[model samples]
Target: MQDSESLQIARAMRRIPRWWLIPVVVLVVLAGLGAAYWAGTSTTAGTESTPPLAAVVPVSATVERRAVVKQVVLSGKVVAGAESVLQASHAEGVDRLVVTAVAKEAGSHVAPGDLLAVVSGRPLLILPAGVPLYRDITQGEAGPDVESLQTVLTSWGYACPVTGSFDLPTQQALGFWYKAAGFKAPTASDPISQGEAGSAAPKPSSSDIMFRWREFVQVPGDTGKVASIAGSGAILADDGVVARIRVADDAIVARADVVQAEQFAVGMRVTVRAGSTALDTTVAKVSSFLEGEHSENTIPGKDITVALPPGAQGFAAGQSVTVTAGSAATESLAVPLIAIRQEGGRPYLLVQANDQKNDQANGQPRRLEVKITAQADGWAAIADVDGLLVGDEVTLQ
Candidate 1:
């Protein structure tokens, strides 16, 4: 009955109502359905929203056993050592650079005082290398160093201000005297009034400085220490040729096993190589360790080393190079890299002094000073391990 009634109504409306009325009713019904669909989708909004995953951080182990060193250290540097400083009698002009020369490259040899390079100035010859120098006029005593220089200058007519002291004017006077005498200009070897000496002569312009250079031949050889003012201007050498002209660059020039002064020490860790075999070298010079310079970019490291290679082939004085020092030894304590601290200009190491409290049964925690034998990467060095017993409970700091 209801269906029949609805059908009748629909027919009646279709027959009586206008087209606009039916269209309006249908549009309103569609809007209502759309609103209901939106409400259903929006219900689970809280459960749908979730952020993305984040990154993870790695954790590192705080303790590990250090490796035991057993290999024979094939001690060697990648480059040759600095060439020896060509020392002359503090003379100003006799080819001041004669003693320097390209004796040989990384693997060559040469005699003493051989012609390495030509320098400007007179060659003075009173002292040999490694002589401690302090300036004084004693060599010419009553013959004051100043008056002697002034007399030489005045005679040459430079009218050097007689300061009664060997100052710049005096040096200039000396230079003038030398040039006027048709010899290379000279510098003082400490400004002493020497009795019978002046440079021989200067060569004509085109002549190489080598022509005016005084010759110094290599005798047998005593591995003696050589020293001079601390600068090797330009003039680099591999085998005697100035491969690099780095002027005014300072470098160290050391002879075999030589250090300045009477201070001698036993360096244990060193580099020793024989062709292909790398030997763990023994050091004898504690001072051999380089104390790097101070600067913004400086990584200061101390050298506890023995002397440079003894008779290492192809090394020269004043060669710029670096090396990996050998292992060092302390009396008996093998102090681990951890447990060492630096404070107030001293190094402190933790020792297992009390056996009762020690977990490792060596000893309990106590502080002791262990003579440093050598250091690498991260570890405390000791020459002997007697005092540091096995299983000594050294804390891993």
Candidate 2:
């Protein structure tokens, strides 16, 4: 009976089926493959999801010493500093006058005592500045006109006292002047003979004096250039302008608008440009008020005189020019204009700290407050600020 039971157990184990065993083995292989694939995918996903470290970009600039200039440029014209308009006048009892000949044309250079033109068939001469000659200065004259004549005579190499009264010495000087001017000398009559009864005194005529009334236009200073002249056939009216002259000794003047004039000051240096040449000059004078009339919307300008240095010639009146006026230079610690930043209407700069041990306090760039005093050529002159020094490395952005 035990042998029969053992044989039956063996038969049952064999009958469990080889097909079922094969299915179990395949399921086991699939589970292992799934576990291995899941493990590999999880490792890759973890590596890809990790965060990266930030990158460090270095940007810096060096502080340097630079010159800062503040300047204003203006447009103007080159004009004569002193100009005079000559008018026609005549002595008492003279009715009409006519221009006969024009000896000096327009743009003619003239000096004291030079002949300008011929009026009423007589030479019209240029004389030194003096009181207007209303009548011929004679030996018996006693007035300021006499003193002026004496001064002119002395200036012309003839020595004579400038006393208001024309004395004997004046008469002698006048005689000498007449001889030098190619005129006949005057003869004096005896005073004692004239005082006696039955003696007729001879009166001096216009031709007897060294100067005549209204025959010359007195020019101020040493030399002048004629700007304009009336035609030779023009009639001489009492108050008609005959010619215009520009004095040579005066400086070159430029008129600036009120806004521009406010920036000008006496003795300020200026650069004047004419064509291809440039001249350095100084401000000689500034007018207190506007000089011309303007429309309601326009503002007139004031006159500004510039002192031309010696040999600064080659400029004409009415020629267009450019003027550059600059303020005093300021030299101090400076930086690039781009380095400065504004926040809340205040200027600030970023400076790199030198101490690396205090990384928590100064790891990043330090902020510094700065004031800009002047600016020029993409650079700014800065006031002294804490933690800012020359040669310090600064962050621009």
The lowest-lDDT stretch of 10 consecutive residues in candidate 1 is 206-215
Candidate with top TM-score is 2
Off by over 4 Å in 1: 1-19, 22-26, 35-63, 67-307, 313-397
Candidate 2 lDDT, 70-95, residue by residue in tens? 66677666765577777656644445
Clashes of 1: 54
lDDT of 2 at 5: 100
Model 2: lDDT equals 0.70
Candidate 2 regions exceeding 4 Å error are 1-61, 64-66, 78-109, 115-121, 185-211, 220-222, 228-243, 248-263, 273-279, 291-302, 307-321, 327-333, 336-391, 394-397
Q: In the order shown, what is each candidate's alpha-carbon RMSD?
A: 17.5, 13.9
